[model samples]
Target: MSKLFNWYSGLGLATKQFIYLFIVTLFLVMVLAYRNLSEAEALLKNQVIRDAELLVGRTNQYIDASLDNVENMLLLLSTRYDLFEDGNEAIAADTLRKFADYNNSIAKTLYLVRTDGKVYANEQVNYDIIGNPMLPELYKLALENYGAINVSEPYYSTMSGHTLAYVLPVTDARRQLQGVVVAEVNLDSLTERIAPMIYQSYALMTRDGNIINRLDSRDKMLPYQAGAYPPVLQESFREQLEAVKIGVSRIEGNHHEMLAVVKSTTNRLGWSLAAFIEEDYFYQGLQQLNNNYRTASVVWMIILLLSAYLLSRSFTKPIRRFVEKMDRLHDVQIVAKLPVTRKDEIGRLTQSYNDMLERIQTLLHKTKSAEEQKKEYELKMLRSQIAPHFLYNTLACISSLAKQQRIDEVRDTIRSLVKLLAFSFDKQSEYVSIEEELEGLRMYMHIQQVRYGEQYTYELDVDPSLLQYRILKLTLQPLVENALFHGISPRNGGLITIKGKLEHGVIRLYVRDNGIGISRTEARKALHDQFEQERSKYRFTGIGLRNVHDRIRIHHGVPYGLRIGSTPGVGTVIRVGIPVLTENDERLGIMG
Candidate 1:
């Protein structure tokens, strides 16, 4: 809104600059921090996934090796054909008991079952080989895969909490189907042998998703399903588990996210081994890294903000000083120059301002000198005019009148001459009111009219309101004299008109004469005082038209000066322009 813009504009320059710098820098810092954090997270997540995969893969290898070892042991024992011979039941039983006792960590029990319904075990027990619930499926599996070791899925056994049956069929010399030597493995013990030291949780499951054993419990025999284990191994990860034979995946858990790695055993068991860890737990270092990054970013932002503020202040400090100095510069008398302390734009501006002040002071001194000279010149011209033909003519007229006893006419003519001399010599001020200048002009014209009676006539037309306006002393008298001598005098007699008016803040004075006018080239040359050398012999006053023009320009500036309009054989009109300066107005200095 306009209000917000106005408010911002009203703020100090330094404050606004600070805001601009800080906002831009803050945006860039945030973007960089976000990018760095994202990259770190991606790298950390990848490391966690690789770690999970390595852990699960190693555990799977251990389980497969253990199963392979058990199978090899059973196959070695099957080579002992004497255990299945007609008279070697005691020996076979003793052999089986020793084997079970020696490898008790893996094998819980050993059984020797014959096709003839004879069943023997490591422990003394009476059992029907065909009727034992745990043995029948294993027996059929052994027979179908004859001469090769076979393993069954985990099953519950009363004696052992969870057990797997490894069976190897015994054959005769004729390759006849005899009985099977069975080993009941404690699944819990086997899983413990393959447990990894760094895993949070691990499980072994059958191809049909049956839970064989888990690290959390020794008696976990339920089918694998949701809620049976950690949520990492639940339905969210089940799809990935079935899709890949060995790989790692990220999945959502109950409260957080987790990484799960699943790998299937390479042996005949075809069991999958999986290990999982929470993302937060696995990448705890990454979390700490993120925290450190955030802390550093905050500190950097604070530093940047402070730096921006200081820089903005430093940049605007000089400008503010310049403005203050400018505000104090109310008059030429009190003007002060600013110091240049740097080579920047502000410093350059200061230098320029100082140069301007010097130029103004120089011009003021020159204008004052010129005004004094002009006043002195006017007085000199008036004193010199006393010895001229005008004085002779006036004296002769007085002498002629005295012989005729015209005493009143002689007194008036002498009084008018004295008044004219006194007005020109008055040194009261360089500038005088328009009315005073016009009064002086009237005195000068009265003397000329007395000498050239009936030869020329003069008229005055000036606005009353403009008479109070001030102008340079003796400014108009020279122009009127120039018209009288150059234009009117050449024709022996002519009518002269002096007009004054206020036009657009300027005081314009026109002196018109219906006399033999000079050419335009002569007018231009006369205004520049080029014709003064030729006309000096006949001119009454040394103050020429060009002196009037120069004085006006120096006081009022170039825009307000004299302009000439003339027509040969017709008339000449010279206009003088000057600004209306009242008593309260300061004398014009430099325009700027």
Candidate 2:
């Protein structure tokens, strides 16, 4: 389960949305389809049972009508004195034959029987009626119910496969029973009369479970037994038949399930008409309906999935574009504005992002301008400090040389001073090539050498490749001057070694002097612009270590600035760190 959750969490927003929508839709569709199918199946079963019941009812009515007709004919014949009189036996037989012929659809034959058990049938006998096993009981029933109609239980005969005897006793005018007129009802003929109403297989059975007429020929005139016929014709179904005049049930049959409906006829025969329908046949239409519903549901699900995919894409497309833009934010000079293509939340987010970029650009422009002004002011201050102080000292040195009458020394000192002034006064740019700055440093050192005279020596050890790279003007000169006056001059002699190198992506320029070095506390103060007042008087210019540090920080950022290291009575090293940039690189902009 945790793994499933992790997998799901890793999916993109669009895929997650699609999965969520599909799952919910699938659940709803399944539930709705199941409910609908269940109801439809129930309704279909009810319809099948209702149809079976209707068929049984109609067939039962037809059977009852046929029985009534045969009974009526027997009653009409019972009133004929010719059928009961002894001398009118021929007339009775001829009358019976004609009556049987007229109602042959229901009656198989007619009989005139005496109380002594003699039988006269309308047709020549295929079987002896006097010797028939049912004759005594039927005759006794006719005698006991004198002048009333009587119906015998079904019996098999050679002439009629299955037959029921409808007996009507004939009496004299004074109500004396002479004989009984019997109409042998062919159950098969009765079944044929109502066959049109019996759509499925059926049976016409007596109240005692005798099947008088059935579509199955093997079961004629046999008592209904479980499993002998359809499995539904069992004891339970028989009990149900007795309980209700019209009823239906579903029961398992021999080959398949069956829908059975039993309807008892409202006649003296007390017979039941049961119709059997195969469950598969009954629900065939419903099965087709179910198949169609399933097909349609699958198609609908496909369409829903497609729609979910499209909807998810529609929502996530803008967010993907927004993320791409954010990735390039720091890599580009200007932040690009995203287009607001909609009035929805994503569009509002895009609008907000564009607004933020505009604000950032404005802040950066203002910051850059302010930093440039600060650097310009610091440069002016450095120039101010250099002009009067250095000019006075150089003029004094030249005057002393002239007073000594050293013409060659005077000419060299004046030429070096002129070169130093030219380098300092030039204001074409605040940044200059390393080679140019080094040349200016050489001129300044020359003037200092004339003043101190053989006290200190200087060395420039720089990578030739670094000469074309740009640095702030007078950046190295202030440090060199501090080394000269504070270190070399104080000791009356020292070696000032100026070194420049490239390390990693930055330029490292170091100035070292083998003279009396300041303590850690004094070095920290000097770098932070907290130098003592006494030391300030000896400084060559107001552009000290602190001024140079601030200029580097303001222009190139805080990481690129001066680091000071010193120990008392040993050498002091001031290392200047700045990004490496050539004359062609953009100054005051992003480093190339």
Candidate 3:
């Protein structure tokens, strides 16, 4: 089954739908047809039994009417004095002769007999029995029965073949038994009378279970005994028969089945009528119905399979077109919109592709502009690195003399200037350790201290752990230079504080001065001096500040940069925030 499914799935969409629809339609039609046929069979069987019951009833009525006419004639004649009075033998014989001739269709012969079992008058075929005893046992029963009519069991008669005799006793007004009148009912003639009542085979049975006349010759010789039916249907048949005097029932056999109905005669005939049909014989029309159903199903399956193929093609055609277009889209900007436009999922996808093309063009233009700006900034940094060499040579000469003369202040000042000049000339690396940056700031402050005497003082308070962390060079020295010149130069006693700490995974360094502070507007200009058209108009020239800001922004993103806060009467604090990075970060961490 799995292999069959794999083979089915490998087929094209149209072919697969065709096969699936065909199989499903066939299965559904077969299931429905089976159910319909089963129901039809049940209905047909019930109709057959109903028809058989009606036939048995009609046959029973016909036989009862005939028997009633015969019995009424016997009763009328038995009470008559003209036929049975004393010294009326010849009249009785003539009367019997006329009665037999007129009712010859029902009764084959009629006879008059004495209660002593002697035949007195014989109507037909009675020449040999004129002086002999006639049906002695039956006549004795009639005598013992007195005035009531008595019916003998079926017997084979020489004159009339198989027949049943009805005997009525003749008596005086006091009910004394005088004689008996006998009428032999011919079974062959009775069968002929009821032959037109039903089309199916039928049988007439006596109360003692005798087979009087069987319409089906095949079953005529088979004697019906007690519990004669198959065991599967015996109990049901007996139950049906016992529930009602006349009803229809089904009887199943090992290789065959039958529908039979029984009806008892209303008149005193002491007989019942039944009709039956075999299953195969009854269901011949159903076989024709099944053939017609199968033929129609085949035709419809073909029609539906063709329709399914067309529908599957219609459903997949658009998807095929979309795939072809996508295969040819080598360049996003040059691609055109799809020609087919319907507001479905495919339409939305086409629109999204068009939007993607526009975004790509915009991103490419911005990327080219950023590349040009980066080259210009590199050129500017190179030009700024070419500083004056004469200042460095002179500071080296002064530092050697101050050390030989033992002038501590002059020697310290020249040493600080030499260190600052050396740090500025080295242009290979843009990032330096925090410790080197702090050392640079300390050297610049020492020169300021020698220039301003005891009025200028500076202190460094920083976390020792952050000494090895990398920061852009010249970040702190510029801020300290600006504070001493702009902030401390105008004050009598001013102090500078450099603080460094790590907070929330960021390195924060602060350079604050306790001097005559600039206004909020002046501090804002100092931070944004690069954007101002006239840069020299601000008190702070901002060359060093802008360089530090640009370097920090170029290395980190815009979020990590320098910020300034100042009040009119209070000092200014410049804070630099950058991601913490050390020499070990190259191997173990992601740097901003």
Candidate 4:
């Protein structure tokens, strides 16, 4: 079994699929053929039985009607008033002759025998029946019966070759026997009466098993022969025949097989009828049906083989294309997207593959760009390092020269400018103590004050308790510069103020300026312009404001950012919100 599995596994996918399909098709065909043949045989057998039962029922009705006709005739003869009362023998004879004349097909001859055993014909003339021993025996039997009707078994007579007799006794109202009336019926008349109702071969048999009369399929008579059939018959090629109310059995003759359906009258006649049909008549069509099934099976197998080949290709072709494309996937080579025409599992797989390739290519490009940018920034930092030290030295020389010349204001201004530039270049300390930030802002504002003189008077009213907390370096310096330039530069004497406080676990810082205050609309435009690449209408360094806003948000999240509010001809206030923290906070000394 393991070797067989290995062999099958070694075969190609299409070959395996075709083998499975072929096996399934063969099994289905065999099962269908078997079931169809079985059902056909069953249906044929049932139809034959039903047809046989129907024919037997019709034959029973015809035979029973004939028996009834004979019984009615006997009753009519027995009921004659003169025959029962022994009054007017001529009238009784006339009544019998008229009855025979009217029903010649049923009663061929009618006669009467007195209780004394004297026989008189329907002609009213007495015959010497004692001289004939056979006639005397019939009268003697009638006398013994006395009052009841009796029918004789089939017999041959010199007058009527083959005949059956009906003997009815005459009795008065007191049930006293008078005479016996006998009616001789010709068997040929029975055949003529039943001729039109028979469409198949039939035999009428007496209780003693003698075949009284036989009729062919055409209802024509065959020669009379004595053939006894018992209440039951055993045959080699047929089902057992028994004296049932109705029965059907098969019979194999010398040359052909036949199916026989039997029904017994079980009446005064002591007769039964059996109908026969040839067995080959039903099986001939079954042979033709088998040939048709064989032809159809061959044709269907051929079609299934062809269909299996095509269906197998439909499955394997797409998979082959996917494998080939995957084989060509490499770092330097770009694989083309597969075309998806169906919404099946294979189509989804193709789509997923294409998306995966695109993400891989995008990450590759981003990695290369990040590497290049890292190198450029490293080079710029090294090149810019020497200039800040040189500027510091120059500022120191100017400060020393001004102090010797007793120019205290110029000396202080140059020193303040040097401190601001040094602090701006301090990249190592991204966060500084709030006190340090305030000190730096004081220095920068002092330089602006020296330049602008009394035109810009600023106040710093920060909560003293918040002076030790850490804040982002250079955050407040840019906002202060914008207020001086964009708010105060346009007016002669403007006030700039800085206020800080701790509220609701947050630090609120506000920078306000009272000058030629911008309108609310203009303030909104200024804030929006800060985020743009270009400067605002006042040519202020909006980039500085945008930088401070972005740094605060990036470090503390969007919840804390710069907010601007102002009114026309009124002071403009810029507020900044940040989570309040003490010296022990984890983020106190961290770089922004």
Best by TM-score: 3
Q: After superposition, how far is residue 382 of candidate 1 from its true place, in Å?
A: 8.6
Point out the worst 10-residue segment of candidate 2 by lDDT: 215-224
Cα misplacement distance, residue 552 of candidate 2 (Å): 2.0
The superposed Cα distance between candidate 3 and the true structure at residue 561, in angstroms, equals 1.2
Per-residue lDDT over 147-240 for candidate 4, one digit per residue giving the tens place of the 0 to 100 score:
7667777766544556777777787677777677787776778776654544355666777765565334332222222353221222332222
If the candidates were sorted by their lDDT against the true structure, best first, what order would they fall in? Answer: 2, 1, 3, 4
Q: What is the lDDT of residue 314 in candidate 1?
A: 71
Per residue, candidate 3 scores C-alpha lDDT tens digits across 182-232 of 888877888887877764566576776555773343442222334543211
Tens digit of per-residue lDDT, candidate 1, span 351-455: 999998889989999878878976765565555543366556766766776788778866776787788767766777678898988887777776676667768
lDDT of 2 at 176: 77
Candidate 2, residues 433-470, lDDT tens digits: the string is: 99999998888888878887767789999999999999
| True-vs-predicted CA distance for residue 50, candidate 4, Å | 84
Looking at model 1, report the run of 10 residues with the lowest lDDT sum.
215-224
Please report the candidate that would top lDDT against the real structure. Answer: 2
Comparison by lDDT, 1 against 2, better one: 2
Clashes of 4: 2
TM per candidate:
0.39, 0.40, 0.41, 0.36
Clash pairs, candidate 2, are: none
Q: After superposition, how far is residue 385 of candidate 4 from its true place, in Å?
A: 13
